[model samples]
Target chain A: MTVAIIHTGCANIFSVETALDRLGVPHILAEQPAEASGADRLILPGVGAARPAMEKLQSAGWDAALVAETRPLLGICLGMQLLFETSEEGGVECLGLLPGHVMAMAAFDGGRLPHMGWNRLHFEIADDPMLAGIDEGDHVYFVHGYAVPVTNHTVASSAHDMRFSAMVRRGSVMGCQFHPERSGKTGARILNNFLEFGA
Target chain B: MLAKRIIPCLDVRDGRVVKGVRFRNHEDVGDIVALAARYAGEGADELVFYDISASPDSRTVEPEWVKRVARAIDIPFCVAGGIRSTDDARTRLFAGADKISVNSPALADPDLINRLADEFGRQCIVVGIDSREIGGEWRVHSNTGDPGKTRTETRATLEWIEEAIERGAGEIVLNCMDQDGVREGYDIKQLTAARAVCRVPLIASGGAGAMAHFEEVFRQADVDGALAASVFHKQVIGIGELKAWLAQQSIEVRP
Candidate 1:
C-alpha cells in the first residue's frame, strides 16, 4: 500500500519516516497538495503551535485536502490537536474532524505542564484495532500542553493534569496525542496496527 | 499519570560514550548506539546525548552518529550542545533527534530559544543550566566547569530560567556544579529554587550515587526527571533494578 505522511512544515516528519523505515514500511513524505493526493493512506504528523501550523496548512490548502481525503489517516501530537474543532493554544480553529475543543490542561496536582514524558494508556475500548497487541497500562511517550476532553470519539485516555484523550477515532480517521514514532517497541507496534488497519 | 523519568546521560566525543568527573578526566565507556539500545531495553525513560566536542571545537552536531543511534533505538532521545541556530536545531531534528538542547549558545543569544520553540515547538527545546552556589546565591553557570567563566550575578539563575520559559523553553536541565559527580545527592537547594519559578518540566542532573540518592532528589525536589551517568555506566546501578527500587519506594517510573 502506498503511504503518504502529509508534511505541514512541522517537525517529527523525519522521526515518523525513520520509524516507518525501521518497521520496513515503505512511505513517502508529501508536502504539496498534488503530492499528498496520491497515497492510499495518510498521516498528519505535527510538533508546533496550532496557529502557525494552521496558517501554513490553510495557505497551502492542506487543511481542506486532509479533511477531503477519505483514506485511513492518523495524526500525531499537535497534528492530533489540529483535528479538533478549536484549540485554546493560540486560540485557533482547527480542521473540525473530531467533535471537541482542545484546551489547556487544568492545574496538575504537582506534575509539570506540557505533560511531557511516558504515561500508561487507558483504553475506552479494550480491543481497539489501533491498539492491538498494546497491553493495558502500557507506557507511551506524550508531549503537549493542550488536549481534547474524553468524549465518545476518544478511544483511549491518559491522565496527567486531568483525564484527556490519548487516542481518538471516528470512522476511518484516528489520531494519537502521543508520539508512537518515538515510543519504542510499543510505538512500532502501534504504527504497525495503523498500517494494517482496514478502513 | 505521567511517570517520573529515569534518563541516562551519555557524554559523547568522537562517536564514543564517555563519563567525566566534574566535567573533566573523561573516560570512554562504550559505543553510544549500543549503550542507548541497552538503556532503552532496560526501561530507561529517555536518553540525553551531549556532544562534548561541539562547543570546544566550535563545530555543529554530528548528524551521522545521531542517525545511527536514532535507527538503533526506538525510544525518545535528545541531542544537546553547540546548537546555536534554528538551522542547527533543524539539522538534528531532521536527523531524528526528539529534542535539541542549547546551553552556552543560549546564554549568548536568549532569543534562539524563542526561534527554536517557534520552528520546532517548545517541546523540542531544553534549556540546560549548570549552576552552583556562590556567595550564598544560586548562580547559573555554564556547562564548562572553569571557575573564571562562572557568573554569580544576583538574579542570573532564576532570571535565565524565567526568561527561557517565557521565550518558550519546554524543559529545564538543572545541573549543579557543586554536587555533580560528587555522589552526595542532587542539589536540593538549587533544584527547589529553580522548581519554584519553573513552569515547565524540570530535570535534576548530577550527584546520583545510589538508589537512595535518586529517592532523595525525587522526594525532596518537585522534578519531573532525574539524569545520571557514572552510576549507570559503572554498573553501580542498573536501570531496571533502580526503576524497580523507585517503584517500591512509591516513586512512579515506567516498567
Candidate 2:
C-alpha cells in the first residue's frame, strides 16, 4: 500500500518511517503537496505546539491536502491531537476532522505533569482491526498532556487523572494518542494494521 | 485490570550486560538476548536495559545489541541512560524498545520532556528518580541512579517531577540508590515518601534482594511494579515463582 507520512516539519518522521520500513513497506514521507497526494494513505505525525503545527501545515498546504485524502490515514500522538478542530496548546486551529478540543492534561498542585509510560487501553468498541492480533488487555504506550475528551467518535479509552480518548476513528481517519513507534511490539502491530487497513 | 509487572534490570557497559552493587558490580551476565528471553518466558513482566555509563567514553548504547534484544524479547521493554536527545531516544525505540527513561534530560531540557510526552504520549516516557538519603532526607539525584553523583538542591525537583507528568511522563521509576543492593529491602520510607508526593504509579527499584523483598515493596509502598537485578541474576528466585508467591499473598500478577 502507498503510505505517506505527512512531513509538515515537526512530527517524528523517522520513528514512523522506521516502523513502516520494519514492516517491509517503504512509506513516502510527504514533504510537498504533490508527494502527499500520491500516497494511498497519509499519516500525520507531530511533536510540538498546535500553533506551529497548523502554521506549518498551512504554509506547506498539507492541511488542505490531508482533508482531501480519502484513503485511510493514521495520526500519532501530536498527530492525533491535530485531528481535532482546535487545541489550547497555543490556541491554534486544527484539521477539524473530529469534532473536539485539545487542552492541557489535568494537574493539581501535587500531581505529575505529562503522562508518560505504559497504561491500559480500555476499548469502548471491540470490533476493530486496529487491535487485531493484539490482546484485549494489551498495554499501549502514551505521552501527552492534553487529550480529547471521550466523545462519540472515541473507539478506545484509558484513564489517567480522568477518562480521555485513547484512540479515535471515523471511517478512513484514525488517530492514537500514543506513539505506536515507541510502543514496542504492540505498537508495531498497530502500525502494520494501520497500513493494511486494519490488523 | 492489567497484570502486575515483574522487571529485570540489566546494566550495560560497552556492549555487555553487567551486574553492579551500590552501582558498581562490574560482572558480565552473559548475552543480553539470552538473558532477556529467559526472564521473558519465565514471565518477567518487562525488561529494563539501563546503560550504566553515560560518560563521553560510552557516548551511546550499542544499537546493534539493542536491535538484538528488541527482536528477542516479546514483552514490554524500557531503555534508559544516556538518552538526552530526541535522536538518542529515537534510535532505541526504532530499534524496538517499548519505552525510554530520562531523568537528567527531563531536568535539563524541560521542553524536550513536554515535546516527547506531547509527541510520543506518557506511556512511552519513563522518568527516573534516583534518590539518595541525605541526613535522613531523601533527595533526587541526577546522572547517578547508583548514588555516585552529588545531589542537586532545587525547589523544582518536586515540581520537575510534576512537570514531567504535565509534559507527558506517565510512570515514575524511583531508584533508591541509597538502598540499592543493600538487600535489607526497598527504601520503603523513601519509596513511600515519593509515592505520597506524586499521583502517578511508582516503580520501586534498588534494594530488592529476596522473594520477600518483592512482598515488602508491594505491601509497604502502593507500587505498580518492582525492578531487581542480583536476585534475578543469581537465580535466587524466578519471576514465575515470585509471582506465584505474590498470587498466594493475594497480590495480582500477570499470569
TM-score of each: 0.94, 0.77
**Model 2 score (lDDT):** 0.75
State the C-alpha lDDT per candidate: 0.86, 0.75
lDDT accuracy of residue B185 in candidate 2: 88
Native contact share for candidate 1 = 0.82
Residue range B1-255, candidate 2, lDDT tens digits: 334567899887767778877776578887788898898778787789988776323366667777777656556678888777788877876666767888765666767777676665555778887767666566666666344553464533455566667676778888888777667788888777777766776789998878888888888887878999888888988888999999798876655
Query: Which interface RMSD values do the candidates have, in the order shown?
Result: 1.1, 5.3
lDDT of 1 at A43: 88
Instruction: Name the runs in model 2 displaced over 4 angstroms.
Output: A8-15, A47-49, A107-113, A131-136, A182-189, B1-5, B32-47, B56-79, B82-129, B139-172, B199-201, B234-255
**Which regions of candidate 1 fall more than 4 Å away from where they truly are?**
A36-38, A106-111, B143-155
